[model samples]
Target: MAEWWRGSVTYQVYPRSFQDSNGDGIGDLVGITARLPHLAALGVDAVWLSPIFKSPMADMGYDVSDYTDVDPLFGDLAAFDAMVAQAHALGLKVIIDQVISHSSDQHAFFRESRQSRDNPRADWYVWADANPDGSPPTNWLSVFGGSAWEWDARRRQYYLHNFLPSQPDFNFHNPAVQDWALEVLRFWLERGVDGFRLDTVNYYFHDDQLRSNGPMPTRDNRPPVNPYDLQDHVFSKSRPENTGWLERMRALTDEYPDRTMVGEVGDAAWRNVAIMAEYTQPGRLHMAYSFDMLGPEFTAGHFREKIEGFFAGAPDGWPMWAFSNHDVIRHASRWASHGAPDAVAKLASAMLLSFEGSVCLYQGEEAGQVETEVLFEELTDPPGIRFWPDYKGRDGCRTPMVWDASEHGGFSEVKPWLPVKAPQLARNVAAQDGVPGSVLEFYREMLAFRRMTPALQVGRTRFFDLPEPVLGFARGDGLACVFNLSARPVVLTATGALIDGAPCHAAHLDAGRLLLGANGFAFLRPDGGLGLSAG
Candidate 1:
């Protein structure tokens, strides 16, 4: 089987935001199938659909209620099958999100488990009695906020919910639960889906002893916005026992041809790099990604450290790199101060794609999409609604994708699930289709450039000892890639014949000294001696 994901680019489609074909004001499977040609034009290797399984929309499909069926909000299983077939026909692989860490409280299994303690599925979920004083079993906190435990009056017990109270974590300690989770993967694989994007891969297991997690040290001295960040999270997630379950998942995928799995290690306290390494070793996940680059850290040193740290820790393990996704603020807006918006978007695409591993691009990233300012009443994300104003949740980044500059940006005939604002509408795909120097065009050009260059695709990376604001690295011995992470121009003396540069930014190699303008970048052939200039 071909390892198609290595060094490939996967585009993420948030189902509710892509397009609404039925005029239901929400995107669905049919809408996604109609957009496969757009992804093919973008030149991505695969398309990753966010959670579309049956749910009550509490966490916007992340809180799955059914493992085998598609939600009516996103269409039925037939729609999902049609979408997968179309994607495969276009030579683009289909990867769907598997949120098995927890399920909606309304799920039949959870409903049964929460019933009488002697029920057949009673132990399917993590359930425990409260402390003598009637407090939660531990200091564990939910990612959304508040205690991680929810009281169940029927069983007179508190169930563990790492997220919303409506979404309860599964008790992986039970061998039967692991078997059921593996069957969920088999169901999708038999459906013709190419791979799986494991959601919260590390949260599959927890300390069986219910040990309390102490406070973990923070690199930055900034105050915590969410109490969950204050605790160490050692007992809540990233447990060593999770690896055995990963082996089961990997074994199931290995049974299918050309199937792959990329796990999302949402570990902050334990430093995701280490967990990514542990989870992706042979016989486990094919690749793992973390939120290290999803935050507000935009520096050459920061990028170098993360890439270097992963390879140093797990030389044989593969990793996935992504700048922005559905769960966080868009990168274009987060790092806007680095340079012009369009320039930064183009530069970020070039830089992220040029890295040494597989890459994932969120919807509308090709058009340099920014976050929408959602009002309190319009907020749909649980976290944003819980912690309003200060942290306006993920709805900003999860706004509908702008396809055209129509009244609703062509996403829907009616208002979308999330409002489509003016600022986002201005950067629609129709506006940048063939425009010169446009962010969309830049993405197309950059993705094509990466496809034809073997060095940029699967080459080994070696960092240069260049000064700050100018991050330089060589991709194998064939290509040398450098970036200007600041808004000020910088020149570095280097010896290499330019292969691809200047077209990306106002940069040139003259007299062995490369002069790069603000937010500039270059790809050079170290062995060639040809000269290049910017006119």
Candidate 2:
């Protein structure tokens, strides 16, 4: 039987920031095709492209207008087809982003829905009448900022948008809407795309009663980060109705052999992991990712708690883990003071590869790049614009990938869409290429190591009883793995020769315990088990 996607590695490529083949200062499909060899070299099984479909670029490419067609800014349908064909030829599966929860205001359905209150497509979106005082129907807040409902003068009512106002949430209650979204999926499936990365997978439904969400009781005694997180957000998103739609999506993808779907469930609470367990068991999504590791907290205890919580909450649901993405601060920048930036990057790669689920390696992370600092004048993200000084928004992480230290960091002939910060340039791929111990090389080695070790790739995990700042876990078939996440050395009692890195050597077990230096980890097995060797 063919194996499921449980232990796969997916490389996420943000199209606009990846590479520019046309010298237009924006990355496109052709650029992606040009870099296919790079992905193949990195040894990832799949590439998850972030929204190359037609869009107004309001929320970058999340506000898609034409789901079936490729954006002219990125490339045309033919270029997409060529890229898909090339990826398959190179043995790399291609996964595209599916933003079904909302559509750009420029979308035909949204335009028709907003034209009038009784248009044929009027109910295609979530529209509600204003309160007697003419306020929004409910106190929903947009993730970007302000109210989630935006007034439409033509309809004389409000339409809901969980994100920016330009992105109107689709009325999944409408069968027509569901059919249309499925058709969008079929379009790509027909084009030979491998799978989909569903954006905002849990926000597909709203409370039918339109009830207001109650405020969250203050627990930490700290002020709320943003008003959006202060409410329970129960009635607004993560409704029970979402599971049915997910099943429908699963059925659609099931028609294609070997196809997969990974949903982005954004709830910071553990509820998102529970929902992921519900949605991806056997027949729903192939896997799901959350924001648990995306935040700034980087202690060993925090990492252990997050992973253990997910495993406990969603015992059967497959998960996808990532250290950096387009939306938040890079891990190197977030956890810099605790460990050396480059060392942390390598350590993260090692730790993530050892997990029990699939992994997502974001672009530019292999180079040990930290988050770029974007000044207010250079900011493009709406969230940054809304919460300036308080929060710099996602533009820092969304900056163009630096391939070389040359002009524009070799990302573009003209200035890229986002400025390539000076600090990031020093960590470009060209600067680290062929360097024996560079972060990029470490990533390549770790990925190669994962592919060769079936236990690392697919084994069940059992965490060890380790102290704070020490994350110890054993993962493999009859193998015990342990890691020390702190900066100090610790002694461990083991009866086998230590094996680590390439050209494995026999470590002298001088005493009953072995000393692990700060930020150190060990993979030990019994003397009679599989002998230690690095791939």
Best by TM-score: 1
| Deviation from native of the Cα of residue 460 in model 2, angstroms | 0.6
Considering every candidate listed, which one attains the maximal lDDT? 1
TM-score for each candidate, following the candidate numbering = 0.97, 0.95
TM-score of 1: 0.97
Residue-level lDDT tens digits of model 2 in 314-387: 77778888889999898889878767777777777778878878999999898998999899999989989988
The C-alpha lDDT values of all candidates are: 0.90, 0.83
The residue-by-residue lDDT of candidate 1 on 39-150, one tens digit each, is 9999999999999999999999999989999999889988988888889899999999999999999999999998889999999999999999999898899999999999
> Considering summed lDDT, which 10 consecutive residues are worst modelled in model 2?
526-535
Which stretches of model 2 miss by more than 4 angstroms?
Answer: 500-510, 526-535
| Alpha carbon RMSD to native, model 1 | 2.3
In candidate 2, residue 472 scores what lDDT? 63
Cα displacement (Å) at residue 180, model 1: 0.8
